[model samples]
Target chain A: MLDLSRVQKELVDCNRDKSSGVSIDLVGDQLSHLAGTISGPIGTPYEGGVFRIDIRLPDGYPFEPPKMQFVTKVWHPNISSQNGAICLDILKDQWSPALTLKTALLSLQALLSAPEPDDPQDAVVAQQYLRDYPTFLGTARYWTEAFARRVSIGTEEKVQKLVEMGFPEALVRTTLENAGGDENMALEKLCSG
Target chain B: MGWIKVITKESLLVAQREDLRNIMDLLEVSEKHARTLLIHHRWDADSLLAVFLEKERDRLFSEAGVTIAEPNVLAPLQSSQVTCNICNEDVSADAVTTMDCGHGFCNNCWTEHFIVKINDGQSRRIRCMFYKCNTICDEAIVRNLVSAKHPDLAERFDRFLLESYIEDNHKVKWCPSVPHCGNAIRVDGDGYCEVECSCGLQFCFSCSAEAHSPCSCLMWELWVKKCRDESETVNWITVNTKPCPRCLKPVEKNGGCNHVRCICGQDFCWLCGCAADQHHARSSCGSYKEEREKKTGQAKRDLFRYMHYYNRYKAHTDSLKLESKLKKAIQDMETISDSKEFSIKDFSWLTNGLYRLFRSRRVLSYSYPFAFYMFGDDLFKDEMTPEERELKQHLFEDLQQQLGANVEKLSHFIEESFDEFLQVDRIMGIRMQVINLSALIDNLCKKMYEFIENDLLGRLERVTHNIAPYESKGVERASELSDSWDSDDSLSMKTCNVDSYLQWDSSANGAGSSESGSPTDDSFDQSSSLDESGCSSRKRAKKEALDDPPFNLNLPAEGFDKN
Candidate 1:
């Protein structure tokens, strides 16, 4: 069984510090599924971007490392451009029970700043990072601008769009709130329920 | 003779005790620390000793996570409470367990960590839960904590640690028996030899395939693959069939003209295998191209050369299979001679000659594949000039033919129905011939191996191939390890689960009795061919022993015929 009390404590502890530049929120009511967001480190190609990561805690949570992968597309050598598989050692065999979701997100932010091209998840990006440095930087910057920028649309605008799709305004508001501000997850909830 | 020992599940700890004791005594460490070092070095004591001599004691101990120094003492606690970073909860001092690394965690969290790592198959080195702390958590702690919660998983962890002697070592390999005999064979000397497992399966120690010597392991692997591929039949199919352009499946023309239609509804010209339309079918597609035939000249010769050796190899193997039936008939003749009024009650000459025939015949059959690679352009083309290759081929073939002819003579004499002979002198003459023939065949087999090992393979450059040296007897039977290691009280208790051992003990006993006992004394004397059918069953029957009272596990290997 997952240590639900520890996970609850972790959530309370991680969210208490706003300056950590990493925050995790439950994707659903279940403690097993979560979403984490980390600000890209400043003075890198990924600066000014907020990268969303999909986190799933296995039953052996805290004992086994939580499974984290990039949901926001970013062009980096160590993070897969195609599927967002990470090649970070801490996420794998080096994972210790002491590590939390917040630490993992911070590690990802560090991976963005210092991409290890030699041990890469994306071979093409790694090759470009090695052979053609300027192009790799350009591609990474363009991808951050294209994908990792937070959707700036207002909640009113989201309500208007769903209202335009023939759902009642009050129901859309509750569903959007229930989906934790994720428009797609809210839309899925709206359609299914 | 190779010093090979058979290690069953029951004898696994006894097999591992030797090395573990050496490391424990040499390093003067506890069993857990010794195990950590041995597992780190993959149970190689000599290499561990080398590292011990070269490196400082602190470095060696720290590298393998064996903590000998006293852990740093902390300041006296204001209260009997401390916080475990993993759970981030305040706990009483009694609830916390500190490792040698001086890092402490709540007992609950530590137990959970051990369970997770053990379940993940990382039991061999479950390091401290603290991040970046490479100190391996003591095995006693792991066992004590894990057994408190999950006894079964702790047993699994124990088995994995015990099995590391075989699982992690290159010198030992589990016998590849179907439905698994639960046995491992440990070869002490060079691994480039063949061994007959106590379960009666004979295999090359290097590749673990059926014993195929004279042919190098590489050559034997290729020959088995080629034979399985049925490359000759495949070549014939390639010559006869054309792939359909639509489906790309090979389509043979059973009886048709130059145009052929596949089941997939694609029509193609048989001459060029190009898709055929109505207009192309009416016209002559093309003339039979002479250049295509010229291009396949080298491949054609290679195919013929392969067929030449393959045919002879198949012929000898086929004779070997048929001669096995002759073994039964000879045994019947022995029975008949026993009841008759003949003075000769001993049939040792007939059985000995038969055993010699089987051994030499195998040497002859495998020699074909050996020659196929030795002289062929594929393996050793540049190793010898054409003239040198020709001269060497003749020299090798001369020895092969001499061995082959003598083996046939021995087979012929063994098959004689001398029991029907009323004249006592007639039986005596045949006995003499059989005895002489057996020794001659044994000598010829020895010479063939010597010539191949010393003259042919020894002289080759740019490639090294070592065949298993010939034994005057057949493949060496791996001996059962004695029960002396039972004195290692530290392991014998936890090495195996008593219930599971009993389950196996009963199952093995059942396999033994149903197959009939005394398989060695009767069938083995007449023919070695009975080994496959009789030997394993009899070995299991003897293994039905070890009825030592309650987990002493003092099972000694039995039923070895010294002769």
Candidate 2:
């Protein structure tokens, strides 16, 4: 079983430092699934964007490392822009149980500032980062601005959009919230239902 | 050649203890600490010692996460209560466990952590629970705490630790027997030799494949894969068939003009594999095109070359399988001869000759592949000049032919039922032929190996390929390490006992006398005479017996005919 108490303590500990711009919240009632947000490191291509990460604590948590991936796509060499997978060593075989969720998020924040191009999850981005630094930076910044930054269209606009798609207003509101305020994905969920 | 030692399940601990004792004595450390060091160095004592010499002792220990701290440093406070960082629980000093790394956690939490690490296959190096602490928890403590709660996991931990000696060490390997014979082989020297496990399976220690002496492991691997796959058949098909232009199905032209129509009603040219139209229907596709002719000619030549080697290799391999049936027939003939009150009581020569045929046939089959790689442009093209390669190929093929001819003669003689012959002289004559042919084939095999080792592969400098040296008697059966090595007394005496035990085991297994190529009576006498000696001379005698088959071919024919 997951060390729920340790995860609980980690959540409380991470939330205590909200000013650090990294926080984790439970995705569901279960402590096993969580969502975290980390502000991009300053003076990097991803600056001013808040990247959301999906975190899952396996049954052997603390012993086995938690599985974490980006939910909001940000272009980086060591992260897959297509699926938001990460290729950090500490997230893999080098993980120490002593390291917490907050430290892992901080490592991601550091990875954004200093991308290891040699060991890459995105070969195209890594090649771009290596061969043309300016173009890579511009593309990364564009991706961060387009995907990582959350747009404030107001709640009324989202409700009105879904209502126009002929979804019940209550269902639209909950599905919109569940989809994390992504309008196209909310439409997909509504259409699937 | 390297000495291959077969380590059975019963001798695993005894086998590991030799290394463990060496490290412990050298470092002046406890057994657990030495094991930690060995595990960290992957059970290589020489490398561990090299690191010890290169680095400071404290650094060596600390780098491997081995902490031999002063007891006072890890001693608990006078206060009765201590808090374990893992569980965040308060426990009395008695309920807490302090590791060598000086990190203390409640016994419950430590036990849980050990269980998790052990189950996760990290039993060999379970680190301290404290965050970022590089110290590995002392194994003795892990065992003691974990065994208190779960004995099975502790047993698993111990097995993993024991197996790490073989699994981690480069010089040792488990006998790759299916259903697992519970034995591992350790090579004390070069690992390229062949060894017969105590379970009676012979394999190359390096590749774990069947013994393929005179063929390097790479050659043997490629040859086996080539034989297993339908690559030759595919090549033949590619050379023979042309795809229909419309259906794209392969169409084989039996004996017709270039303009052949497929069964799918698609007409195609066989020569160029292009669609045929009404405009040049008189087989104009057969007109010579340099590029197409060159490509087709090359493909045909390659296919023919492969077929030549494959056919010969397959022929010998098929004969080996067929000759195996001779064993049952020979056994039946032995029974018939035994009941007939024949003059000759011993017919081990027939069985021995049959065995020689099987061995030589295998050598013959593998020799084709060896020749394929040696003389061909695939591997040794740049290693030798054309003339040098031609001369060496002829020398090798001459030896191959001599061995092949004698092997066939031996096979023919062994298949003869001289028991049906009423004349004693004829049976004795057949016996002489069988025995002489066996010895001749054995010598030929040895000579071929010499040619391969010294003349063929030996001349190459850029590529290093070592084959298992030819053993005329057979693949050497690996003897078990003596049980007395486990005890702490009389090392020389134990070594002597292990030698005698191996001889006794070989004799019991029936390979000793038969492989030595001596009549059963001579081996019985030699073994009995060696039994009287106390120590070192027996090993020397055993080694001599293993090197040469002690057959007295000069004995008069009347001596055997009088029976």
State every prediction's TM-score relative to the real structure.
Answer: 0.78, 0.79
Off by over 4 Å in 2: A150-161, A169-193, B231-297, B322-342, B345-355, B381-388, B417-422, B485-563
Worst 10-residue lDDT window, candidate 1 chain B: B546-555
Candidate 1: clashing pairs of residues: none
In Å, residue B395's CA in model 1 sits off its true spot by: 2.5
lDDT of 2: 0.78
Q: Which digits, one per residue and each the tens of the lDDT, describe model 2 over residues B388-416?
A: 88898898888888888878777776667
Candidate 1 per-residue lDDT over residues A117-161, each given as its tens digit: 989899999999999999998999998887776667888899899
Query: Which clashing pairs does model 2 show?
Result: none
Best by TM-score: 2
